[model samples]
Target: MILPALLGLGTGLSLIVAIGAQNAFVLRQGIRRQHVLPVVLICGLTDALLEVLGVAGIGLVVERAPTLIEAIRWGGVLFLLWYAWGAVRRAMRPEALAAAQGSEASLKRTVLACLALTYLNPHVYLDTMVLMGSIGNAQGDPGRWWFALGGALASLGWFALLGYGARGLTRFFATPRSWQILEWCVAAIMVVIAARLAFGGIEV
Candidate 1:
């Protein structure tokens, strides 16, 4: 059980630590110190819910449906490429970082955007539903639940740290260079994931 749990924790963090739209949004909100708590809760809870669903056998269903998987695969590839393009464009803009610091979106709007980012992204399904689920189920019966629990805990821990700890780096991200670097990292991660999905298969 301990081994499975630890495996889950490591795997969960590995997937979540990748710089994606959801993480970028969370980090931005964290830096701004606006609606951080709610945003973090929503992300953590949603991830936990998805992880549970995956571990409960949805992963198997996804495996059996090659057509559905193919559809999702292509869709994810397209969305990720588009997202990467946006990141690259933002990285090239001198004012992009400064502008984000000044904007104060309403909580309602922010929440809506947060939800959209979580659900609309195809990588979320691939990571949480397909990848993580299959991995967790591999742990064996009762141990798989322990793995899921560990993964859920990892999700909670990561978002809590990212959302609350972002303020500490508020000064660092103030520089346009920092923003450029961050956006470039996001672009790279998105492109790599997209490429892997398109050519390397969905095991990652």
Candidate 2:
């Protein structure tokens, strides 16, 4: 049991620690000090929920429904492109990046964006539902539950660390130039992820 749990924890962290779209958004929000609690909550909870579904054998159902995946894929592509455009626009204007300096976003909008970042990306489904799910189920009945628990704990721990730990870099982002560079990085990440999703590639 302990072995399966530890295995799940290690595997879960390995998959999520990559600088994906969700992590990028969470980092930005953490640095901006905007709706950090809610954003992390949604991310952690959504990940746990997906893992549960996957472990419950829903992954099989979802796998058979390529149409649903395709719809989500396209939606994610459009949203990511739009977000990338915003980042590019901000990068072009240092003032726009500076606007986030000590700025706060509405809770509703922030939550919505967080949801979009969480759900629309096919990678999330592939990772949490399909990949994590398959791995957890392979642990066998009782062991699988322990595996899921480990994975869920990992999500919560990671998001909490990411969302809160980001403030440590607050001093660095004080400059407009720093914000511009950050926005450019975010834009690049979003564009690349969007392209990969469109092309049916999940990694990166």
Best by lDDT: 2
| Tens digits of per-residue lDDT for model 2, 168-188 | 999999999999999899999
TM-score per prediction, in order, is 0.76, 0.96
Worst ten in a row by lDDT for model 1: 116-125
For candidate 1, lDDT tens digit of each residue in 1-204? 899999889999999987777888798789878999989998999888888999998866766777776777787678678878977998999686689667777999889867866775556777887888999988989998989999999999999999999999888887888889887887887788778878887543
lDDT of each: 0.83, 0.89
- What are the per-model numbers of colliding residue pairs? 0, 0
In angstroms, the error of model 1 at 47 is 2.2
